[model samples]
Target: IQAFATLFQYGTFDRFPNLKFVVLESQAGWLGYLLDRMDAVFKGPMGATTDMKELPSTYFRRQCWISADPDERALANIIDYVGADRFFWASDYPHPDHTGDYIEALAELVAPLPSDTRHKILCGNVAGVYGLG
Candidate 1:
């Protein structure tokens, strides 16, 4: 959260708009709150503290992506609100702490989402983030 906030606060994205910032191996449920807080700060009196020309969330939606843990169920509910194109699935495959079969869990978690949102989270977003065709 700190790094995410700081980058926006420092106008990092403003200077390098095309840079892709991917939050990996991290649960994505906190993005909504962070976006809200950052936007609030940007619009508040402290807004002048940063040289940015856009809201923090605006930069986020344009230049950032979050890797959602396959088991994070709450995230599915907020994907559309947070921008379905801003997310991608990450299983942390082969990591010892991430043991057990999570494919079924991933499938069930994403099953409730709309088809396009599900497709973006599962495949399209990653390609978009990395500039793949």
Candidate 2:
């Protein structure tokens, strides 16, 4: 969260308009609260004078993507709050704590979502972000 906060507070996004920031290995559950807090502070008295082309959350929505572990139970809520397009499903392959079978982990985590959202998280969003298509 502090990493993201620094990016916004220091005008990193403004400095590099085309850069795409990816937050990996960190779980996605904390993102919603962090974004909310940033926006709240930016709108509050101390931050009302913040000089930026857009709100902190606006910069995030435009410039950032985050990876969530395949088994993270809060993924759906994170997607709903932070926008589905911001997430990439991470298999954490080759790590000791990673799932034994990536496909099974992905299926279990994505099964409850609508088909389109499932497709985006499982394939489309990452592909689009990385230009894999």
Candidate 3:
């Protein structure tokens, strides 16, 4: 994740505002803390080392996406923190840890979310990430 921080701090998002950075296989529970930490570090004394046009977290909000596995029950809180638009539901299929029935897993994870947020995480977000939007 430091690589992501380095890229954001170094102005990669600023350089290509339309570029989308996706973090796959990594659940998003820690992203809130990481983004907050980046914001603080960049705004602190170390700010001089970076030439970002916006707060580090702002760049992330504008250009990053994270994939959440179906079994991660904590994603609800992450959704609240990161916004539903930033997440994509991934089955992580073919991996040993993935569920054998992806559809069932997806249904279970999405059951508690509101319709709009559920749609975003399961469909719209992935479409937009892949330029299908």
Candidate 4:
């Protein structure tokens, strides 16, 4: 599993530099685990040989976004760790697993964040990523 994780991490980003990837429904807590391992690999001998200019976590920090259901407590706890800029709130509406009234829930969840951060996550971030504006 360890080897596979390492290889998969490198391969995914390597193959898709322009890909605006978002991990949907994957709880945000796992992102910290992935980042830690990727950072470790970057500092180790394996990193020196890679074609990537920056550490894998660096790539993730800049290029990746993740969606979490509004009600996911684990996601709430880890939001700061992953950087709020890279997170998008998802209603997963009509899906049984998603909480109803996700917009309201998201508003509440992000209320304490800086206004700029809240504005970005609530709308501007997705718009920028998807080229909507």
Question: Which candidate gets the maximum TM-score versus the true structure?
Answer: 1
Q: Which residue pairs overlap in candidate 1's backbone?
A: none
lDDT of 3 by residue, 10-124 (tens): 8898888778899998787789899888889888888878978788778878899999987888888888877899999988888997759899989989999999999999889
The 0-to-1 C-alpha lDDT of every candidate, in the order given, reads 0.85, 0.84, 0.87, 0.72
Pairs of colliding residues, candidate 3: none
The residue ranges of model 4 lying beyond 4 angstroms of the native Cα positions read: 1-8, 11-16, 48-51, 74-77
Give the Cα error of residue 128 in candidate 1, in Å: 1.8
> Which candidate, 1 or 4, would have the higher TM-score against the true structure?
1
Candidate 1, residue 114: the lDDT equals 89
Per-residue C-alpha lDDT of model 1 across residues 1-133, encoded as one tens digit per residue: 7877889888899899779999987788888888988899889999998988999888988988898886787886667667888998988787787657778878877888889988898889988777787
Residues forming the 10-long window of minimal summed lDDT in candidate 1: 73-82
The parts of candidate 1 lying over 4 Å away from their true place are none
Better of 2 and 3 by lDDT: 3
lDDT per residue for candidate 2 within 1-133, as digits (tens), equals 6766888887789989999998998888888888888888888785756555577889988999988897798888888887888888888888888858888888889988899888888789889988999
